[model samples]
Target chain A: MHIEFEFSGGYGGLFAAKPLGYRVETDELPDEVRDKLLALIRDSGVLELKPAQATGGPGPQRDVFTYSLTIGEGAAAKSFAFDDASAPPAVRPLLSRLRELAVEQRMRP
Target chain B: MTFHKCNCHYIPPHVLGNMAKKGDPAVRQAARTSAQQAKLSREKRGVQAPKVPEMLTGIAMATAPAPVTAAREVYDCQNKWELRVKLARGEGDPEFGDDDVDTVYGYAETVRGYFAELGRNSIDNAGMNLRLNVHVGENYMNAFWDGDEMAFGDGDGQIFTSFAQSLDVMAHEMAHGVTQFTANLDYYSQSGALNEHFSDVFGTAITQYKLNQTVDDADWLIGNEIMGPTLYGEALRSMKAPGTAYDNPLLGKDPQPAHMKDYYNGPNDNRGVHINSGIMNRAFYLAATDQIGTQKAAKIWYHALQNLWPTADFDDAVEIIVESARTLVGDGVVPEGTTQTVRLAFKEVGLPS
Candidate 1:
């Protein structure tokens, strides 16, 4: 599922809509692929990553999602989660539009 | 092969053969760990972009460094969101100079060029690649390196400005590249904090060096501009004192631990690696301690960071600094005995035994 972007930007950002969580086939995946996924932790577009939270208690929870990223400096072992806030008007409109378009495209099939 | 190359030069103590009889498990563990990290760094280094002599889009042979940091191109949303077209530097056609919110991509485009230019000048043998990705998130307060590329964010502005406003932050992020290409320290616990501290130490240190300022002259704050204008504190992390950077009501106090005995531990990826990094962050300050800009100070740190800190954790880092000082000045009281002084300074914070 796709996650909705909401709140202020960056790590402490929140999600307006619920995140579309996916369970990757971890054990079967190759190291390079795992590395690539870990790299995405630093990516900004991502929001509401639950598994990404490695430390500190959760802040005002609004459907927190977990995503794994390299933690504490560079170790891939630090799993951390994030708080999901409402998306701002500057970017949320775009995501809602995209979501609508996606549904339309799927329904066309 | 006996010397495992992780950070600088890690001599793996062979328990089975050579000078020392079966070394204790501690030594063995150190050797094995260094060997493992060495293998990882080697593997990661191997993944370099394959040689491409021909330019894909006329980037061509590198030109002379720009006279100043230029904001060449800006892409409003109407333009294509393609990185290649944007990177193919050129004068504006239709969309280049508007700061319109609808097309704010121009600022990011300029940052991209800054990195591209930096990448060419910083040679591979020198061991670095300039990396940057802007427009990171909605209103991200902080930006950092994840052992690879640089990330930027539009700050909360309540406590900071955009991340780009601070050159030291850029230096700090780039130093991560230096750290990755060099020591490749395990980014957790003390080593992790060292990783953070080095980034800050080297980060702010380079900024001061580049700006031609001395230690007393340097502000010694990390991500100063990233915080909002209203905030009383100056930076995200302070090399002199970690958690003391900010104590705003919003983000709460910075929680970086200051000493080894006070080190934070949790299952969270080698214990709050980032939080605990304050200890080693303090160590580097103590190591570099009094002398800020002199070549002598940088030299001692360079020796330790380059030759000594290969796989050193907190205590190990202090040991290496002492060793590095001895190697640099050799015997009898060297000014501050940079290495010895570093050890002493760290002892002040309870790092070195």
Candidate 2:
């Protein structure tokens, strides 16, 4: 499986304007990292969550990160959007791990 | 870490009544059970509900008497995504000895005191309590105002640091609460930008006041103190010179526009709420430096902020701000020609565009 992640929008546009992005192929990763990512993905149940469930509720949430994630590739790819304020409890671990990978990879435009 | 769970005791009877009437079959049954459980819990605690009309009960709940003085509550999240996981300290409590908690507590005091000087009781001007959460998550890199309270994150230590350490950041988030209670600006498009602009205005003004720095003495930069080693000396935005705060490979160049001609009309950042705010910020900087001073300039802006309504755009802001400056000038709060100075400052930034 392939994964793409982006983190943006926060206080003072520090992380915004130019969002941090990363793309990784599960097969290309070391065995341990690949297993962890796969585990988190399974735990997230991202494929099953509805848009309303994934996104934040109504009302203003200031200075919080907005996240975009995609899993798989081509026709099989699935995408999801959420923010730090309203990410579901089950989906948080996956988002945290993706953020770590993006920062470690130094992925940017 | 202690895991706080919501039980029947926390649900108000009015909410339970509505739920029992409107919820689905399973939800209705659960609501009824919860209501019964709540009554039992109240009796166990020796708390009794007042006998009143149903509508009056809701009114009383909604208008629950506010505290005469606001209190501060700081929670330690223990590097988890959850908030208020552990009570680290409360108002008048001894320092927790944790740097993050201690620093945030002090900053909260400074913010509360500053607002009091402006004749504001608290965020709601009703002595609303301040709830702050620190160490929010593992390598969390942001701080936020979630309408009711504020939360800070210990950054990854590469691109940012503990947001709790910044006084201006705390004041900025708290000002969002003030905006919420006052104008209640919609968080999108132009109105959203005004919301952001007012926060930045208060953030800088309060910081300057706390530091005892004049307009000439201040750097007029936001988020400069939070930058970690990798991005040291690079700020997130510069009110004095918009679009010039930062330029680097990691975060790209700053995208703020100081004038309406270069305004950002993109769909990103909630229609450029943070981006377009630079125009207004520059306008403020100009007015402050033109002898009116930051605090006085802020007073005018605050006056206008209270008068603004939801969906107010840049043009609406210009008219209201100028009117506010005029009113302050007439009252001798600001020096003569203060209104013209404000108008000229807005013209310099291409406001009312």
Candidate 3:
């Protein structure tokens, strides 16, 4: 499975210059890391969630980070957009894990 | 029968009745007396009951149940994504001894008092309660205002620190509530940039007011105080000099544009709401340093904010802000030549574009 994650739009536009993004292949990860990422994706139920389920209606929310995630690619791909207020509980752990991975990967030479 | 001064005679009977039933004790007594006087006056003249206009009646009722004071409510999220998970503090309660909780409590008071000095009751100008949540999630690195309340995150301890530790950050979020009630500027394109600009305006204004700092004394950076050890001496945005706040590998360089010629015309950030705001923020900085002073310039901006509409653009803001300055000058709130000073400030930033 290929995973792509992007996060932006927080207070102070912290990511305005360069939004945090990551693309990783599950098969390329170490066994432990691969298992953890796979588990988070499974627990998130992202494949079953509709786009509408990721948003909490049109309302005023300020300075919240917006998240975008994609799994797989092309015909098998699933993508979702959500913000801090709209992200469902089940999706949060997956988002956190991806964030950590993105930071770690970025720091790697 | 002696007639008391019916100060509320113009108020419709139905509205006054509602106030009598629902108002605070003082308002209730006054409403009752006013209602009785109105009835007696009608009977004395043998006049038929006057028909109340629906709009007028609505306004009366809406403004009747006035909030006497703004209360503060602080919640601890306990590292959860959920909000208000636990009530950590309330208005007038003893100190919780938690730094985040106590710090936010005091900052809320300062923000409330700052607006109160301007005759604003609260965020809504109707004494709405202040709701805040701290410790939102594990290593959460942001803070936000979700229409009705605010939430702060303890940062990842590298690039940032506890967001609740910064007064300007709290004030910035609270000012969003004020903008929502006032101009209600659309959070896209120029209007969105204006929305962000107004929050920064109040954020720095309230900070300077609390710290007794003048234009020269203030650092004029938005998120400098929140920088953790790794990013110390850096900032998120620089109102004094846009696009110069920071430049590092972790967060990249600041992308703010100080002049309209360099305005970010991209689709990102709701059409550069945060990016384009640097233009206006620079205008404010120029005006403040040019003898108009920060608080006075803020008053002009606040007046414009109240008169502005949801879709108001940059040109509209410039015109309204200048007119507001003229009005304040006439009222002796700001000094003479303030309108010209404000116009020049905007001109420097390529405003009214």
Candidate 4:
């Protein structure tokens, strides 16, 4: 499975100059890494996470990041956006992996 | 009152979290590390030991004057997440040789002076110890008031810089502490916006007071000096024109709306607390500029703040401020027309009393 994702929200949207986004496929990774990533995603209940509305309540949670993820594409695409402060335990690994991919994508020449 | 633990942050989580996604390897690593540290901070909260009950060491004599003075402690996180790791400076320590430590110390004292000038003690209005942790994480690009203390980050040196370099930024975090002690506005919607509003207000006020600048002579920009040279933005936010702080290639246009009609109803940004704050900020600016000036306007708002509750929204703010104006005027504190000027100011921002 391939995942498409985007993340934003920070000091006045500074990092958002270009959102980190890319497609990550299992075949593109080393065998063990791919297996670990896939397993983490599968078990993390990322698919069950309901879409989180865009809102970071003021107070302690101010300026927190928000994420949008799509497990598939086109009409069959399943997308969800969530606040970083409220990321579920099962979804954290996926979030971490996506961030890693996004950074790599962003650094491309 | 329960001293609520607040995750007060200088750099919004989204900003730091984004660094984890799309920067150079070092940037991404720092971002990820800082994010993890921030998360761990929450867990640390759970494990925090309850404060030992205050020991009754001695009783004060009635003839002795009560001693109340600012007490401060500055710690160095040493580019790690843990707070209070190494003692860097203290209230009366000699120069620590670190610009971050010395700068935060000076700024904190200035903020303390601002409050003391108004007869308010420290964050708790009872001279609570001021605690700060600097160098929070490697390339960390934010600072915040984390409920009991303040945290500063050494910026990534590219997109952002050290948070300690800016007095207004430091004052902004200090102002957050003030709100926690005063109205303690809820961190949702309008209340959150108001919380941000007061911080911005005092942030600018302290800056102006420090510089000895008249209202008109002030720049009215927040975080302009500390934004570093990488970005083309002028400042983080502008009080004179809310949405006009910056419009750069990287950060897009400022999203703040000066009127309720342009209020942001989107997600993240704590229900646009920082964004929508432009409205109230502009209102305060207008009121302060013409009718009452910054000093009186600050006093009026400070009074209104004391009268507010956690859930007070924009409408409630209008009512409380107008009432505060009346009370201040009735006591011959401020001249007449203060209330009218305030009402007209809010009305201009679509919040009529």
Candidate 5:
């Protein structure tokens, strides 16, 4: 299964979005790394995340970034948004990896 | 080869190592724990933790004399969030025709005046110059101490006003600098909350000291003036009533907890540094208003801050504050009942006295 991600807010305003059925073969990543990453995503429970608040607090979130992620597509598609100020602990590693992927995608020719 | 550096910070390793050998078991354990954590923190920060001589029996390391004058610098980000923007004003510079610049410069001087009156050399106790950046980000609504200098935002015009408008916000950020120079409290978990707590404490202290307001007369609301007319809450955080700072349509209700049982356990907000600090903040408010006056309470808290380690937690805070108060009372620096008042205050906050 492939993952789609979008991010905004904060200083950088890094943003991205992907439609459903975006698939990446396991061969794209090393076997060990891919397995570990897949396990992290599976255990993250991202599929059940409800939509988070549009803004964090009454005060402006200077360094807080908002992230929206989708796993799978069509009837199985799940999307959730979280900000840097209040992102759940279990999903942090996944988000970090996705951020790296986003950066790599940006640098490609 | 990776160099293993001495982990102890602020306090020389030789001093703590000597305590580890000669002091009681508890002292030894604390020294060891501090050393270990310091090493880990150094590793994380990737900075060289200087190693001092194991046995400095009677050596006094040569150091430069501290500057006597306070230096202040303010910068304008020009609505950009990037740091190190153009220097708008410097020490003794003429006004830049900018309210935020003048406010930050004047406030820094005010904070410096308080510290000088208290016999503190500067933020680092070495006369480190105060650096401030204002108008950070387009409509950004927050101000923070980035471990070295202070940064402020203009705030979204609709929801919040310029952060520089509030004296307490400036004092609060500068107080973080003071804590950095003294305790260098780690910025995560309970220690992080303590760091925020000490900032808030001195934040209110500077405001009261400047305005010559008594504990009762003071509003005890942080960022009180920076709130826009349309915002829901009166202030960003309230020391008088921790959970009642603000609640409105644009901004959600304040989530700060006033007691230990209500402490947030989530992994967000750096383990709820801003949220749980309300407990200790209230403890100080209670101690200052009902028990001892703000002067004695501030002295006791400052002493306690100096006694705290980087990894100190809530219990450590209670213990140190009470001990500091008792010591001050014994020395006649504070009146009697100070320690009892401190204990009662902590007890009221659901912390062991």
Candidate 6:
């Protein structure tokens, strides 16, 4: 899924920079988002993020990102979380650099 | 190359522009390079990387249930809203009043009353039957709606409690379902805020109705029951007072803005939709509380919610209420102080001021 963003607010100015939001499908992620998602994979405490690409694609896209968030997949954790947990990290920071990248993309005129 | 997100993180687009157009080249370069490198990396990585299982991807991804690759491994919790029910040694014990029945029935009863009160007796309350799972993610410190069902975690038994303890909380999660079915409001930004607003509106209404209290008697707090018993946090947010919703260090102070003037901006969490909902909540609070004399006065707030609210954004909501007020109260009489109060409150927030 390659999701295209048709912003509601529309870049207000010739130089308006806004985060282009989209609905996720899981398998397809834009190039920038995929990079940071992947970056988190090798960071720490993360072993691997299973076939979530096809899952995280938010609209239409060519590829997916690599997310390395494996907080509670243990026996105890598995019994609790929903059958489909989120791939993206909620307490983001380690991905601050990636976020900045996303910010930059939004800022692009 | 964008991440499909609603982004309610409070970092507005103009701010990003400031960082880019005015900030140091290092910041701009860093941002640009990150975007560039990410694109290059995606091309390099392709689809080879395995995606994370769907079972553990919420805020508490660290402690989500493992993916069930099997065709059928449903942990029914047997309609029992109790965690201990699942731990019955060898399953020979009698069926416990896990509260699951009560939870399910409670939802049914609430909806029944809701429709009756609004003459929506035929709206089919069964459209959303809450499938709550208690004691999720073992000692997990978080609970969230996963676009489908509602799941609760035994909050590390510290920072929070079982997310199921709060009726308003349950109503909040269930409200997400209503949004998904109705407007399918995007989960971040204005749409996200609208989404949260719906939940808060519905959740608060359901709680109030369940308690048989009108708007004046109800505490306009969202997730008051979901707060950590050990900490000093009020409900997740206070419609009466936005910024002061929470003042803890762990989750940080609540960033919710009571008025549109303070509306947050960001790319994450759909531009802080959840935080921005405070504005709407406050609007409802102000509209209802501004009233002077009323012993058993009916609530236009709930009337708007059950009979009028649209799954859509503020504008759609306003239109619906204005119309519903007409239908509920009069044709040319106009709604009472409560109805006007909502509009005035919205105006006060700088939305249309």
TM-score of chain A of each: 0.27, 0.87, 0.89, 0.73, 0.67, 0.25
The runs of at least 3 residues in candidate 3 whose Cα sits more than 4 Å from the true structure, single-residue gaps closed, are: A55-58, B1-69
Candidate 4 stretches with Cα past 4 Å from truth are A1-109, B1-44, B47-69
Q: Which lDDT values do the candidates have, in the order given?
A: 0.46, 0.84, 0.84, 0.72, 0.70, 0.45
| Residue pairs in candidate 2 whose N, alpha carbon or C atoms collide under 3 angstroms | none
Instruction: Give lDDT: candidate 5, residue A26.
Output: 40
Which prediction has the highest lDDT against the true structure? 3
CAPRI-style class, candidate 1: incorrect
Query: Model 5 off-target regions past 4 Å?
Result: A1-109, B1-69
DockQ of each: 0.05, 0.44, 0.32, 0.12, 0.05, 0.03
| Reference A-B contact fraction recovered by candidate 2 | 0.53
User: Native contacts recovered, in order, as a fraction for each?
Assistant: 0.03, 0.53, 0.58, 0.08, 0.00, 0.01
- TM-score, cand. 1 vs. native: 0.55
**Model 5, residue pairs in steric clash:** B233-B246
Tell me how many residue pairs clash in candidate 1: 37
Residue A25 of model 4 has an lDDT of: 73
Task: Rank candidates, DockQ, best first.
Answer: 2, 3, 4, 1, 5, 6
Interface RMSD of each: 13.1, 7.2, 11.3, 5.9, 12.3, 14.0
TM-score of 6: 0.55
Compose the digit string of candidate 5's lDDT tens values, residues B1-353: 11122222256655666775777866875665445444544543345656565224423233313433457879998875465588999888999999999988899888887877776777766566788889876666667665457778787675568888777888887887677656667766798788888878988998898889898899988776776766635777789898897765433467788989888887555566777788999999999997587877989999888778778999998999999999999999989988888999999989972
TM-score each candidate: 0.55, 0.85, 0.85, 0.71, 0.67, 0.55
User: For model 1, how does the per-residue alpha-carbon lDDT over B1-353 read when each residue is reduced to its tens digit?
Assistant: 01111222223223212322247754543454445433444443443322344333334324313322223332122222111223322233354342332132333343233334433223111323334444555454445553334555555466557665566666566555555544556654566556666666655665665567766676666666555666645556676776687664444466666776766665443345456667766766665646523335555555566543434677777776677777766643346445556666778788664
Report the number of the highest-DockQ candidate: 2
**Chain B alone vs. reference chain B, TM-score for every model:** 0.64, 0.83, 0.82, 0.80, 0.82, 0.63
